[model samples]
Target: MKIISNKGGKELKLSFRKVLGVAFIIAALICIYFAFLQQEKYIQGNAEYKKIKQTATDTPSDDSKHTQDFQVDWNTLKTQNPDIVGWIRMDPSVNYPIVQTKNNSYYLKHGFGKSYNINGCIFMHADNKSDWSDPNTIVYGHNMINGSMFGNNKLYKSKSYTEAHPYFYVYTPSGKMTYTIFDVMTVNDATVPYTIDMQTKEDFQSYLDTIKKLSTYQMNVPVTTDDHIVTLSTCTNHGRQRFLIQGVLTNIENNNRVGGGD
Candidate 1:
């Protein structure tokens, strides 16, 4: 604004530069406010998961009381939210309850407690059979900055990291399923038909062949057409790009079907 004094009269007028400066300041404050909210949300989301992990999970004692003792208490967890289909765990940091809903978008914005959370939760593809009977099962999570919820999956880009963490487990109500990591790559999400169902053995093999060619690391793990595979996918820093870690089923324990969804 500018003030002009002429012949005992004073007038005020708006200045374009001043107005533009005020707008810039407003925009900056808005950005800062949203950034603060996002950080707080992430903190709350992490805390909630930590609490859930403590309350809804168990570990076998050294004595090995029961061979069939699953790490996750599905009965208790399902009571909290039936959408939680399974649990995924790796040796130290990568551990979370995998949720599934009628559609793919719900869990991407909601946590295990079904609360609004930008950090989201690890979730299975909506089209996938909860029992994991399908030949290819795809899981999704956000590339959280705090290294939670498949954010660590980005580390798989390093061949050494991939080698060091060779296996991860998915615990269903029925049994514990183990998978060996065979391929890791970051690819354009739009081009990859990640949701395509491999109907026939030949089609499955072809799909495997196509992905293996894109792998950053060639870990010598044999994948056959008959085997079941799980694909862990998360967003990369680049827009419309995704990092994937593909694994083949190597082991199954406590095969009896029991508790929770089929």
Candidate 2:
């Protein structure tokens, strides 16, 4: 009887050990799987970045002079993905091609190259015209942990940061336009930034004033309703809230040398 009892205890111990070992192995495999997924995402993002840079640099026109134009090889980009609408470069942080579809949901999971990607592409609000002729052109991107998309945009929450990086550029088929940073604010997802309609100049000016008051940083830049504005918005705190970096069209350089756009 004593021998049988001891044998049973030993068997139980072995079984417990086996269970722990199996659990550890499964946990390790999960870690490895997630690591591989992250690595794959990094590779895809890097490849897209390289392709865009190469296309932008391959213009047959004088490279030095063309740099000033900020001309996008739209034909090539459209060939890859017809959703390609424009490109945006925020000094020292963001340089990305913008995409637009009939709806906003598609690009949240698709790249500018039209590949499924976790990093996603910068996309304009579907409600706005793809030509960027809206009274307020609002663009959205993920606040990626890797600082790839609009992740660095969170830095503008700092007053000093906005002062250092006060402008961003938008290049459309019509022209290259410069937007001067005016307001960086955190607001509920349904606030004026997301829901306002600016049909009249007075309405826009009132909207501007409200956002300016809400801004985390006070910018001396004057914004009138007459100015075409661009709003860069990204999710913060799991989409319950948003961080908006708003800018006014400060300057524009068109192909015909006639600046500004409606």
- Top lDDT hit: 1
Per-residue accuracy of model 2 over 1-262 as CA lDDT, tens digit each: 4543588889999999999999999999999999998988877875786677677534324321224534577677778878878878774457788988888789888877778888789998888878776768889999887788898888888878788778887877776788888888888876787744678878887887787778777688987767788889999976578899988888877762222212
- The TM-score measured for candidate 2 stands at 0.83
Candidate 1 matches the true fold with a TM-score of 0.81
Scanning candidate 2 in windows of ten residues, the lowest lDDT window is 57-66
- Expressed as tens digits, the lDDT of each residue in 3-97 for candidate 1 is 76573432222465677889999999999999999899989999988788778876434212222343677888999999888888764366789
Give the candidate number with the greatest TM-score: 2
Residue pairs clashing, model 2: none
Give the distance in Å from residue 162's predicted Cα in candidate 2 to where it truly belongs: 1.5
Kindly report which residue pairs in candidate 1 clash with one another: none
TM-score per candidate, chains pooled? 0.81, 0.83
Candidate 2 segments whose C-alpha is farther than 4 A from its true place: 1-18, 56-70, 256-262
